[model samples]
Target: MSLPLPRDLARALAFFLAPLLLAPLALAQQSGAASPPPPAQGATKPLPVFEIPQSGVEFQTGDTWGQNGQTFRLYGIQSCIRGTTFTNPAGAKLDCGEASIAYLAALIRDTKPRCTAVAQTASPPLIYTVCAAHVGANTLDLGTVMVTQGFAFAATDANGKPVNLQYAVAEGEAQKAKRGLWIARDLPHPTAILNKALRDAERAQ
Candidate 1:
């Protein structure tokens, strides 16, 4: 003879057994291991276009290429800010910023440049990236080229460390040749100019 279960005990037993009883049914309904949903029907993928959007900048498709694009800042290079001028070797005031922009545009003409993001900046929403700009069968590091040609300066990281040692070396070479901004004897570094600007803005506030 078996004893009958109490009303509360019977309810508790049902609750515990419900999931165990339904689990096999759920498994049987599934064909195999679960799989990701397929891509939407008739959805066309966006192709990457390699074009300079602005001075000293380029962008390409990111991991989510079709959904969102990524902008890349040429790593380890700083072009002069607009309206800034420096005396050249010929003692003429030159707009270094504009020259840097033009040089970068010419260097990347008609080539598909691909970049790898190495770091990110928050204030300006920029990604620091190293890019290989291809010209025919030759490839060039855009940042290194800019520094070596004296069109830009070797930039520093957020922590104040040099962004790239190679870029520093290239900058030294450019300086030795008295190329670009290095022609001036007492001209301040671009970074110093930028820092002074920031300090002035803060003092005004």
Candidate 2:
């Protein structure tokens, strides 16, 4: 066994080592260098958001698709789930999910939006992304269009809280205006459906 460090020797070593250990931070602070803000709780660092190629792009739903063997979804929007229906003004029932998918596909065709992948999720390895498209003289975030136009919804966690709060604001405006799917009296909200599913799964467990 090694001999215990003498109290005086330990004190002397610490006194001499403290300044060396602290010098870089002190110098950085003195030079006005700033450290990057820490990532949000339970959040990963976002990947670089470069323009994704349009080749092999396929629309799987209103808010998700596959490209180059990778699945990608809009960062803050949820498409209506398949098998849901809503009423039109003629009292005829329309498939809400199909409508969302159709609208998204049309927008993609017309606008040819460019996206930047930001994060990835597991279970099938889905990428979350933000996209932009030009409409007239203005460039718009694609999620804003999807939610604000009432075709899609502000995406939420299992707790029913929006993943991106700004999308919630847009959704509110769309709701107040009663646009697109919002005009239907029987629109089945994705968040409601998802939350119910979560609760059901928990109860089953």
lDDT per model vs. reference = 0.52, 0.68
TM-score, per-candidate, Cα-based: 0.57, 0.73
Cα-lDDT of candidate 1: 0.52
Best by lDDT: 2
Instruction: Quote the RMSD, in angstroms, for model 1.
Output: 23.0
lDDT of 1 by residue, 1-205 (tens): 4344444233322222222322333233333545322212342332223444334343121100111344345645666554556777678887655667667666665555666544343332334446687767999887777788787776653334455567788988999998866777755465566544444545666
- Runs of candidate 1 with Cα error greater than 4 angstroms are 1-71, 89-91, 110-112, 121-123, 157-160, 184-188, 199-205
Error of 1 at 23 (Å): 50
Question: When superposed on Cα atoms, how far off is each prediction in RMSD?
Answer: 23.0, 17.6
Residue 25 in model 1: lDDT:
30
